[model samples]
Target: MLPRLRHAAVVAALVCALCCAPAGATYSIVACDAAGDCGAAVATHNLAVGASVIYAQAKVGAVATQFETNPQYGPKGLALLARGVAPADALQRLLEEDGGFDGGDIGERQVGLVDARGRAATHTGAAAQASAWAGARSGEGFAVQGNGLASAEVLEAMAEAYRGGRGDLSERLMAALRAGQRAGGQRIGAMSAALRVATVAGGFQDIDLRVDAAADPVADLARLDDQFHAHQAMLGAERAARSGDAAAARAQRNEALRLSHQWDRIWRRAARLAMQLGEDERALEYLGVFASANPVWAREEVDDALYARLRQRPQFVRLREGLGAQEPGG
Candidate 1:
């Protein structure tokens, strides 16, 4: 009778464990191991979890709480999830508090707190599938993805990566996710991938890439991977256009447009700069190219804007007169 009761107890425990296990889900992160092309290359977007908080409070750079939620867990940043709660009382208020939730179903709560200076923190909990799920934290910022994931492992790893990650924090966070996917991500499938990398000093300003429906998460990550380089090309074009040298600006603008069709804006801006430099012929050619490549730019507003500023130039008058009369496409 005793043996039977013990066996029943063990079975019940096993069932509880299985019931509490987290379902596969999604989170955010930084960077990615994207394909070499301009497809959907990986971008940095990490979900800040735990008692940890990252901050860029001063010019000295960012700082992180470096809280280790579960010492018994794997590596320093392996598996962790942080709620508004903390391991200690005094440090509790330092975490970001978020009762609001988004994404999928709430299971394991995790966070990756990061400030402008690149600081980070992490926290986790033992609460699994209670009557309800609620989480909050302070100090560092929070990125709450409501859905519960397979385990807190990826979030914890991402936190560690963000804190100790070399180079760009966002990029390193992407690399960390890549590592997690390899370790055994959601046993099911990922519906989408989203990334958000924010910083005052970073080149790309608030660029977001989302694959709402992809057969392969990694493939989508790859697509996001290339977007970064294309983004760089766009920025470079902007810089070149701003440069005083018209020739240099043209070369950069051409390269920028080559990387992504969206960069045609930079090309138009370059054309404006060329016109300002008294390079009216070159400006007309650039504007003509911009109009041809990006029909949206061929609007009357753009034409009027440039023409309004250049009526005094002889080349401008000739260019205006020859607009519809010259060239096959232009």
Candidate 2:
């Protein structure tokens, strides 16, 4: 009799604990451009949910599966989309395959899908936490979803931001993420955030950044995006120089250098660009900064033909000699 009573008490305690535990929350947005460039941004109270909750494949689509989240849905969903499955049908197939937390009911899962064609679909499980006020909204070329949100307005604001924001797909998606957070975001706040954008046949992502954990993940994510853009400008400078647009190349290189003056690679590349543009003094200045930051790069000989003219300059010779003197063996 006593054993039976104790068992009942234990079960009751377990039930109470389960009921009191806080539900996890995630807010996410996915958008596609007219050129079929797809991108996704997500913020969650959980660490690195972006890695699992947001999945996107170039020329296919983006997926955000959350709320009692299942990680497998990411890759599998993209694969289905790659196979030419419609967004709705792909989501349904995921539901069919996984069934649900229970036997066959997905009453607690929240998912959003957007294909390369800009077709979108969203689902919010009926059983999502009430405090979260789970909901989703879809627009012309984007979808926003949230679980454990402060209210339905969270997703609404995200959708509105995506629709009204200016700039490219990444900018619009970031604007939506900021809007969702301002609209209350998750009741518990955010710890992790991510942004990923893929261009059609571009062979590489335009933006891929993640803030795994931070006091202000969204802000950190924005900072990362700024850095990414600065780096992209540097790449543009390189390409412009290769294409014989010296004036455009110089402007782009200067812009990147202004944004990130401390980075060794940017300085090195800028030095080379200035040399090619016949800006000997500017090239020497850039090389000085690069050598100071990266002693190893100074020790290596400049082999690029673009620097042949600058290499004959007295300042260039002195810079290399100074670097060699600073070497360990020297």
Candidate 3:
């Protein structure tokens, strides 16, 4: 009877441990962009569980809390900043209030925040995984923190990468994430990643990407970032075309095409823009590229509304027919 009682007690303890433990081991960076926008990005080893780990309110601040994460801390910290609390003071309030839960084991939490003014703060709990080498670092415009990392060098590498990289806040944040991965990522690797940037307008200004699950989340995130830039270039081309700047439109479209050769949509858009500019040879070239990349467009005789001007061109017809011939039933 005594042995059975002991066994039941042990089982209950294990169940409680499993139920109460948060799922993710995470690394994150928060920053203020050159244009004074603020944002945050985080990567974690739990599928879809860390989306809320990083939070930002445009022109207010950004926050990321992890380790034995209490996601509520993210919003609460940001709200504190929104009310004019200093970054350090806001972090203190979070640490103080965090004591009301989980038997006051605030030492198990890690957090980082950057205010709209570029003030930064970070904290790492003593109770984080020993193998993780948990740590935090802060600089002029950024804060980086991590737990369940292979070494403390991971934290330093991220900070250095962000400080040294050029371009916008999103680019620097991505550099930091890649640096952490190269230095030695989380002990179990990552499954989900997210990047968000906010401007004074309170929306995604530059980037807002999420990878819910992937074998290599950081690498996949880099790919997504490239795709984002390609799309942005395409939009710039369209805007230039609408403004009647043919040279600028052509340059932007060519840049988009250079960035993402696999993106069939860019080829199609480039063809339409060329047609609008009356560059018939360039239009035919783009159409041929699009048809070669997207066989279905040719097989179904699908014509874009913008391509009406080119519908009767012998070169365009030949390109479409050539593409159709590659289909099984053609």
Best by lDDT: 2
TM-score of each model, in listed order: 0.43, 0.76, 0.82
Q: Tens-digit lDDT track for model 1 on 51-159?
A: 1222221112222221122212211121121222222221232222322223211123333332222233323322222212212222233222212344556545444
How high is the lDDT of residue 231 in model 3?
A: 78
After superposition, candidate 2 runs with Cα above 4 Å error = 1-22, 101-105, 151-153, 258-262, 284-330
Model 1: lDDT of residue 136: 24
Worst 10 residues of 3 by lDDT: 1-10
By TM-score: ranked, best first: 3, 2, 1
User: Candidate 2 at residue 49, lDDT?
Assistant: 65
How many residue pairs collide in each prediction? 50, 1, 0
| C-alpha positional error of residue 276 in candidate 3 after TM-score superposition, expressed in Å | 1.7
1-330 per-residue lDDT for model 2 (tens digits) = 122234433543455346642385889998787878888999999888667788777788888887777777788888998999988888777766764444323445678889888888876654543334777888777788887888889989898888889877787889999999998988888899999888776654467789999999998887777667668889999899999998889888877887674778888878877877778788889888988888887567344456667666788778767876443333
TM-score of 1: 0.43
Clashing pairs in 3: none
What CA RMSD would candidate 2 show? Answer: 7.7
Deviation (Å) of 47 in candidate 1 = 15
Q: Which lDDT tens digits does candidate 3 get at residues 1-330? A: 123234433543455456554433688899986576787778888876346678887778899877777787888998999999999888877876775365534556678989888898876654553334667889998899887787888889998999999876777888999999999978777889888887676433456789999999888787777677777788899999999997899889888888774678878778777878888788788777777888786445335555566667788677657765442343
